[model samples]
Target: MSAASRAGSLPANLQGLWADGLNPPWSADYHININIQMNYWPAEVTALSELHDPFFRYIERLLPHAERTAKKAYGCRGAVAHYTTNPWGHTALDGRIVYGLWPDGLAWSALHFWERFDYTRNLGFLRDRAFPILKACAAFTLDYLVKHPRTGKLVSGPSNSPENTYIAPSGERGWIVMGAAMSQSMAFAILSRCEQAAALLGVEPELRARCREAIANLQRLEIGSDGRLKEWPEEFPEAEPGHRHISHLFGLHPGYEIDVDETPALAAAARKALDHRLAHGGGHTGWSAAWITLFWARLGEGERAWQFFEKLLRDSTESNLFDTHPSGGGPIFQIDGNFGGTAALAEMLLQSHAGRLRFLPALPKAWPSGRVRNLRARGGAGVDIEWKDGQAVSATLRPETTGTHRLIAPQGQRIARIEANGKSVAWKDEGVRLARGVVYRIAFQPAG
Candidate 1:
C-alpha cells in the first residue's frame, strides 16, 4: 500500500540515525516525544566522551516515567483534549496541541515513525507499535477538521504557526495565517497514509472521502504577495525583526510538499522570505538553523548547507544538546530542535533533494573523515552512499521508488552513462553513480 520505496542498499549501520560530524542520541527522544506529557526541554547536551555515559544514566532515570506517561496519555488518543497545562491552568496555551483539534504533535511523531519504518522496514515494530498509532492519528484528524465557518471550507483554524500569531482584523480572533500550514501538510500526509492503511484494513469509501475533502480544503495556506509565499494575509503582518518558528516554510524542505520541481516560483519566494528573516536579525534559534540547513541544501548551496549545520548545531543547541544562541533561551534538550538539527545534518551528509538521492553532496570542509550508511531520503529511490577524502567514493542505488531518477555526478558533471530498469543510457560511463559528492538537481520525472 505504501507508494514511497523504503528499500535501499546502504550498509545497515547508517540506516536510521543521523551522521554528520557527531552523534546525538538524546535528540532521538525529542523526535518521538516519548512521553508527550512533560514539558521538559528534550535533554541537555554536553561533552561527548565526558557526558554520554552519565546522560544515558539520566535517561534511564526518566525512562520509567516517560513509559508510564506515554501509555496513559499520548500513545494515540491520549491527546484528547487541549489544555493550558496543570493545576492552576498555568501553562501558556498556544494553539499547538489538542485532544481533538490540532494534531501537530501526533503528526510530527508519525512523520518520524514513517521515516524510521521506511529506513528499517522492520515489521515487528510496525504491527506492534507505530502502524496502530498512525492509523489513529489519521482518524483523529478526520474527525477534527470538518469545516471552517468564515471560509466555509475544510480549514483547520485556531491553530497558530507552531507558536506564532498576530491579532486578526477584528482584533478578537487569532487567525492562523500559517494556521492551516500544519493541517494542510497533515491532510496530504494523512490521506497518503490512510490510503496505505486502507490497503491493509480494506477501509471503505467514506474513509477516503474525508481525506479528499481535507486535501480540497487545503489550498488556503498558499497565499502569495508579489509572487512570494505570503507569511500572513498581508494586513495582519509578520513578526517584525523575525520570529523563531519557520512554520511558514513548512512546504520548503523536509516536508517534500513543495519543491522546485512542483512549486518552483513559490520555492523561490520562500527563499526571499528566508533572506528577509536572516538580514533583519531574525536571530537563528536551534530549529531555525536546522531549517536553514535544509533550505540551503534544497537550493544547492552545498557549502552553505555545511556551514549552516556547523554553526547552527554547534552554537544553537544547549549543553543538554550540542550548542545554543541567546535570544530564545529554551531547553537545551528539546526534541523539535534536535529533529531540526538532525534534518540539517542529514541534508548536509546526504540529500535526496530534487529527485536523485545523493551522499556527501554538501559536506562541510571541516568534515572529511566520516562516513554514513543506510540513511533513507525521499525521492522514492533508496540509495546508500559513502565517501573518502571528501568526495563520494561509492554508492548503490535501488529503484524501489515508483519514480525515475537520472543520476548526476559530483561537481555538477554531465551525466554521460546511465540506465533505468536495466536498459543502458548511452553507456558513456553514464550517470557516474549519482553525483556522489555534490548536490544534484532533478525533476519529478527524470526523462530519458
Candidate 2:
C-alpha cells in the first residue's frame, strides 16, 4: 500500500494497486465515507507515517472542488465532499442520495490531518496544513447544521448514515434524516479538533468560539430503549438490521468521542449495538468484520475481537489472502478489509487514541505468548512488547521527542518498575517524563 501511494499523484484508492479491468468496482474511486480513511488507519500506528503523505496531498487537491460543491449544492461556506471521489476530484454528490448526500466526508477526511499531527506532534504541519483544512471543514459544519425542532440541538441532515437506511416512526422507510449518529459524531470529532488546533496555533478565536458553541449544541449520542446506540436521532427501526456499514459505531473506533473508561455507558451502548448487528447477521463483509474487530479491541474485549478477526480471515479472505466482499454472484476483492485488519492487529497490541498509551489492551487468549516490534504510539514514540500467558511482561519505549508521556500497563496488570538505560527511574502512576536519546523499559506485575 505504501509503495502504491509513495510520491503518487493520487492516494491509494478503492483498489490500491490492483485495478485489473476497465471498469473496476465502484470505479476504484476514493470512498471518503470510510474506505479511503480505512486505507490509512495503520499508517501512523504501524511506523509508516510517511505513507500518509499521498492522502494528505489528495485532501489538498479536493479542497477547491469540495468548496465549490459546498457553495453550489448547499449554499454554504468552506467545503464538502460526498460519498466518493476520483483522481479528477469529483466532490459533487454521487448517484443516490441514500449514500451520496453525506456532507461530512470533508470533515471525516480532514481528521487524517489531525491524526497525523496527533501521532507526530508536528506543530508546523498542525499550523500550516492541518489547521487550515480543519478550520474550513468546521466552518462548513457550522453553516450546515440546523436547529432540530424537537431536540433544539444543532443537527445535520438531509443526509443518510452512509449506505444505511432506517424506518421512520411514521412507518416511512427513509434514507435521509437529521442528526444521524455517524454524522453528529464526525461533526463533533472535527469541530472539537479544529477548536483545539486553533488554540494550539493561536489563531481564529471567533472560529474557535463558534466551534465550542456548535459542539455543545450538537446532538449527543443516544442510547435506545433496546440498549443499543441509536442510529438516528430517534429510535428508528433499521431497514436492514444486519447492514454492513455499522456507521453509528464510528465514535467507538476511529473517533475518540466514545471511550470504554471515560464514557462507560456509551461504550456499553456501542457494544450492545454491535452485538445486535452481529445477531442479525452483520459483519458479513470483510471490511465490516474488520471494523468490528477494531470496535471490540477498543472496548477491551480481546476474545470478541479475536473472534471477528478469525471470521474475517475465514469467511472474507480469498486464496491470495486478498479481502473479498460478497456480491450477488460471489465475493469481489476490496482493499479496505486488508487495511482495516492490519490496523486491528496493531490496535490489539497497542492503542494510544484515548489520551494514553496502552499496551496489549486486547490480547486474545488464543495468543498465549507473543511479541511485537516497532508499533508507533501517539506522541511520536515507538513501542515494543513481549508477553507470556497472554500477559505483557515487558515493554520497551523509544521516544522521538523528549517529554512527559502517559503509559498504561496491559489489561489486568500494573507496572512493577521502570528503567532508563537499565537504571531505576522515578515515575508516577499518572505518567513519566523522559528524555530523548535514552531507551526506557517497563516491567509489569502479573495480575493477581
TM-score to true structure, per model: 0.63, 0.98
Model 2, residue pairs in steric clash:
none
Q: Model 2, stretches more than 4 Å misplaced?
A: none
Query: Pairing residues by index, what is the TM-score of model 1?
Result: 0.63
lDDT tens string, model 1, 1-448? 0111122311111112232335433322222221221111111111011212222223223333333443454442222223222212211223334222333554544444444344434455444444555565566565556565555666544454554555566664354542456556655675566555545455456766766667666545464655556655344655443765555676665466666556777778777777776776653666567667777777666777777777775777656564333434353333344545655666666655445545455676677766565555543334555555656555555543343344545543333334444555342222333322333222212123
Residue-wise lDDT of candidate 2 within 1-448, one digit each (tens)? 7766797657888778887899988888889899999999989999898889999998998899999999999899999998888888899976888887888888898999999998888899999899989988998989989999887999988788989988877888889888899999988998999999999888989999999999988998999998899998778788999999999999998999889889999999999999999999999999999999999999989999999999999999998999998999788899899999999999999999877889899999899998999999888888999999878899999888787887888878989999996699888877898787689999998767
Model 1 Cα displacement at 72 (Å)? 16
Shift in Å, residue 304, candidate 2:
0.8
lDDT of each: 0.48, 0.90
Model 2 lDDT on a 0 to 1 scale: 0.90
Worst 10 residues of 2 by lDDT: 1-10
